[model samples]
Target: MIHIVFNEADIPVLQQAISLDESLQGEVVVIRDDYAVGPLDHTYAGEGREARLNWWREVLAGGDYEGKTDTGEVDDFKTVAELVGTLRRNPEETIWIWAAQNKHDVSGYYWLLHFMKEFQGRVFILYLNNLPFLSEKGQLFYPIWLHSIPPKEFLKAKKLARPITLSEFEVDPDEWIRLCQEKKLVRILEGGKKLSQHDADFYDIDLAKFITVDWQKASKIINQFQHKNKHTTGDAFLLWRLKKLISDGGFDTQGEIRNMKDFEIKLKSQHQAETA
Candidate 1:
């Protein structure tokens, strides 16, 4: 089954699309995690549960409401696992779509992550309003309340069952830089040329007089400039530099990164650059 993961920036729109497509109508289910209980039902209290029931009434009408929302408040890890297994083995087409409504609502991932491991079904993620560091491409499961990792990245990283670093997913660092450069936002480097993906990381990147070696050096430069110079400070620069430095796409618990497309892209792009 094919799954398309999207950010929660467009939930109402997504709900509309899911509603319109007969094939997709009943196939998709949304899961939400609870956060700080507000003066109202923000914390998924009895009222929050009832509120959620009402919200889904309009959203999931004509489809099964189930009248049940699984909050981590209860310990039902095994039940969740079983549900995932059943969904995956179901002959009917289906999509388990999760909406991380708030930044602190990351507890939802615990169960979903467990489910995905056992169930071989399509899974998609959506991150609604999130905090900084947790908004990396729509995932908010980082250390700072589930740091902002991309939803797909978070899913893959969870499957790997390890802490994620930038290098874990970024195979084509130079290619990524090129994409940034094409956008003409790469200025932290003088003549920053591409390098093999292995060279980009938090440490062990030798410039050797090249413009910019990899993301590792770029972050050091940015942080140094801010710490030592104090002349440059901005979210844009930090993000750009961080994105550049953290493109290593390193290994997993198996001690290997086997995604060929990411590595292959670098060589293919480099060859094209050389020929052109």
Candidate 2:
């Protein structure tokens, strides 16, 4: 069996779980790419590669999209290619995909399906987004990431895994394409629809407003909003957007914004003038 998961950060926890259960033993593959905030073209050809590179060059130039950039040299394609090769060679092998509803995991799942057309293998998907697991205190938890589940909780999830039927795969790939076309910053569940970044709680405007109020330090602003807002974004993502705001003259920086805590923000005169 082969195990594929989206984030490499989750590998240690997964490995620890596998150690507990010998039946879960398999090589864990992490395709290190963030499909959530970048342009995606589904084709694995020359034109598609160029399109991806061009898109990454624009979006990830800010250097905070998980610190990954798509070089035109096919460096990022190697991991997925190797996985596809392994699947092609082992026709009867069972491939297990550990995924969630997040764009990163879902996109990776779709990319794998694109290459599975020729493999006569049985594919099992452990979709963790909605899987309910029993806690030690017998509380039920639905986790967004596999790392959130305890080792024992993962064992409970393992029993509920199911194979991806041919009919499901055939239709899912189309849905994946539709999702890609949406080009959202985040994929969130809403009103029975998987929508894109529309529900993203953090925005450039809000950052500008917060930073301008007392010219507070970035750390204070982050902490303030984290407590005030119901939906909070990570400091890195907020800092990334803050940098973009600076670049676009919405905010002025007092120092090198090397880290989220490194800079203090002041509202730009130009932005204030426009708003006034």
Best by TM-score: 2
Supply the global lDDT for candidate 1. Answer: 0.32
Model 2 poorest ten-residue lDDT run: 191-200
Deviation in angstroms for 122 in model 1?
Answer: 2.9
Q: Write the per-residue lDDT of candidate 1 for residues 192-242, one digit (tens) a residue.
A: 122111112212232211123232233344445545441232322233333
Q: Estimate the overall C-alpha local distance difference test score of candidate 2.
A: 0.66
**Global lDDT of each model?**
0.32, 0.66
C-alpha displacement of 119 in model 2, angstroms? 2.9
TM-score of each: 0.25, 0.77
